[model samples]
Target: MSSAVDTLEQSEAYMENPKLQKYFKNVWLKEKERWVSMYRVGKMRVPVGTNNGVERQNRMLKECHIKFQVDKSLSGLVKVLHKDFLPAGYKKYIDENALASDSYRSYLNYIPPYLHNRPPKIVKHCMKRLNNASSIPTDDVTRVGCTVFKVRSSESLLEYEVYFGSESEFPKCSCPDFKKWFLPCKHMFAVFNKYDDVSWNSLPKWYSDSVYITLDNYVIKTSDYNSLKQSDIALSR
Candidate 1:
């Protein structure tokens, strides 16, 4: 990545343009650590390498929700966001995903009778990756130690070292996806599938954070309330 950056910096267009040179030296170089995937990997939990999520949200707010509301006061804008846009968006998400069932919502307060011991969304993601691990042939998974393994990518064929740590430590994979997201990648799942007695306690504490669980509960309740309100409207009609 650094080599590519260096090559771009040495390009004729970059060398000729003083403003471009200034921006590259002053802003890009200084802020590279925050935006660069190579620098950010293993340092942050979010796997996103760009500000695309924030940019997309901002674009939605400006273009879709507030395009013709330039005369509105700050409080009125907040009202639109809190009372109209956000609720509608959340309801749409919940309805489309079908995530507001009573049984699923109950898992927020207690550990579900599951192996992963993570939030519903997280557990789903991990299980999806675990299923994908089956695509990687057994020949790709080479055991280096009792708790260590070298798993080769079925696509890239590149080898990654996976370490399933003890109860006190978290598991780790050398794969870029695991390093960037701080989540279990398919390579680690391959090792887990191979071993029957692998410890689930080795997962990071963030997976079990109360804050995320609470947020999930709040979303579920909001969805349930919206559904009930819609049903009431239909009954009245």
Candidate 2:
């Protein structure tokens, strides 16, 4: 990433434009950490790299719900959204099985089929990466300790260390992807396939906490307002 930036800095087009160069150095360089995914951590690491979803939803609201009507008053718009749009969207969500009853199960009650306990989206990502894990040569994955393994990258031929920690700590990997995303990488999955003893306890609490809050909030909103307030308090702590 730095190399790419350096190359851009040296380009004739960039050098010729004084304002562009000033903007690049003063704004882009200074704020790179905010925009760059590699510098993000914790919840920011989730794969929300694009605003396409927001843009699409906005487009839907304008085109479908408002029907490009610009003359509606504030209350009129709210009435349309509350009475016509939101309910329709909610019904569609339920009809599509997006909000399943199983999703509302408490952490203690939820027993994931996979070794690691993750949100469905993350589980799907890991399932896709399993193919890459399978392709890894057994010789490439060297067990360093009971909780540590070194897996060589297929593309770069660089060895990255994968660390399996307790339930309180997130499993770590030396790979750039893991460092950037704070999520399990292919190397971690490789270790999981190799070792039978590693269980769901190896996963961090953050994912489970996030899942619990999201599911519980969704169910509690209409059923129990006090429970929602309690959930908020727990989250704040």
Candidate 3:
């Protein structure tokens, strides 16, 4: 068997055994199993290397509004989970499954046109005040699609939302500003613009705008990416 296949099988064997799977769940089995399962289960390997989509968002939820010492009200937590977590996950899912079936048109509709286009003038004006090269939210570096917030001056950095997918196709930005003003924020523009890897999930918060854009490759990365990309995702019994 090919090396990739062998590695994949080993992963399956380990996952099938509950005893073996726990090691992975606890972050024990480093690379061999971690990547094998990630690519196999997440089904995609966008720019970020694996489907860190869900994990990244969760981390943001805890770090931003949910501090460890302070406890939020039940209703507040619900708002955070619904308004924050659920939409983040669904956005990633919809972006991946778009164009797969006519039924997914509802999701596709959310992807805005001029998505790839640069931010509008008014948004651009707002962005001018906040153009720092190193201003990402959250020290936790594992997550992607974070919502960056401005501090007292929109400069020093305050908080960020874990944005996973863009509702737009082209100049994809996950920030609410993308919708409120139709301009790609620095983070979204920065990530999508630079990386030609087609896997946005892998790229860091920086280097997004520094890269040039091209038409040859522009596929968004999602959790189910690996399965969808592979022709052999499913087999007939």
Candidate 4:
């Protein structure tokens, strides 16, 4: 099957080096899975075909490398990455359009967020969350102060004001799941996940940033449209 490496090799038509063929051919042949990965996503205009795109991507990654190295933690990097992907264009989500492409889901993930134009406020909170929790675990979270929470169900949303004194230890989330089954509830995590930093305008606009709204996953790619055949891509070998 034609793959990304094949595409890269194909693009060598405009190149001067014959040695590149011998070298990349060896690399491509050795890496069977990595080779065919690009067809799995419809995001990038190209994967390995041209030099300009790759060089630009590398330069962007280097900037991220600098930020993370200074912060000294991977979490800051991840949070920063999250904010970077916030809506401002420059992203291609995997919807029906992305799926219509032949091999768009098997091996591809989204681009690293560093390349996007991040706003100051969002990125400011991101850097702080990263800097403060740089030495801690992802699940190794901390909480302080009080915040309001709204719990939603099928019928209604319940509002609760959780209070923690200035010197008191932050309480675990009072959501039914955390209270009854000892799980990490969204509200409990939200109260302190956003860094209550010194700056006000720079503060993040989310308490639910740490919370995720996810549906159950299936072994196969689920689609709402039937224009394309529905094959079990989970086992597409």
Q: Quote each prediction's TM-score.
A: 0.64, 0.63, 0.23, 0.19
For each predicted model, how many residue pairs clash, with residues at least 3 apart or on different chains? 0, 0, 24, 4
Q: lDDT, candidate 2, residue 54? A: 79
Write down the lDDT that model 3 would get: 0.40
Clashing pairs in 4: 39-103, 40-103, 40-104, 76-130
Candidate 1 local lDDT, residue 113: 40
Sliding window of 10 residues with minimal summed lDDT for model 4: 207-216
Off by over 4 Å in 2: 1-30, 41-44, 52-54, 68-71, 86-112, 115-120, 137-139, 154-156, 166-169, 212-237
User: What is the lDDT of every predicted structure here?
Assistant: 0.64, 0.63, 0.40, 0.37
Off by over 4 Å in 4: 1-25, 28-55, 64-70, 85-237
Clashing pairs in 2: none
Error of 3 at 57 (Å): 0.7
Q: Flag clash pairs in model 1.
A: none
lDDT comparing candidate 4 with the true structure: 0.37
Residue 92, candidate 4: how far off, in angstroms? 11
Candidate with best lDDT = 1
Worst 10 residues of 3 by lDDT: 228-237
**Model 4: per-residue lDDT, tens digit, 1-237?**
656446776685625577777765677566765535434331111223466886865566556443455554678666545556332112223232334233343321321133112222333333443344334333333333333333323223544333321223333344443443222334333443444642222222232121111111221145334444454432121
RMSD of each: 6.8, 8.4, 20.9, 23.3
Candidate 1 lDDT over 87-147, as tens digits, reads 8787766653334344333333322244222344555566678779878887888888877
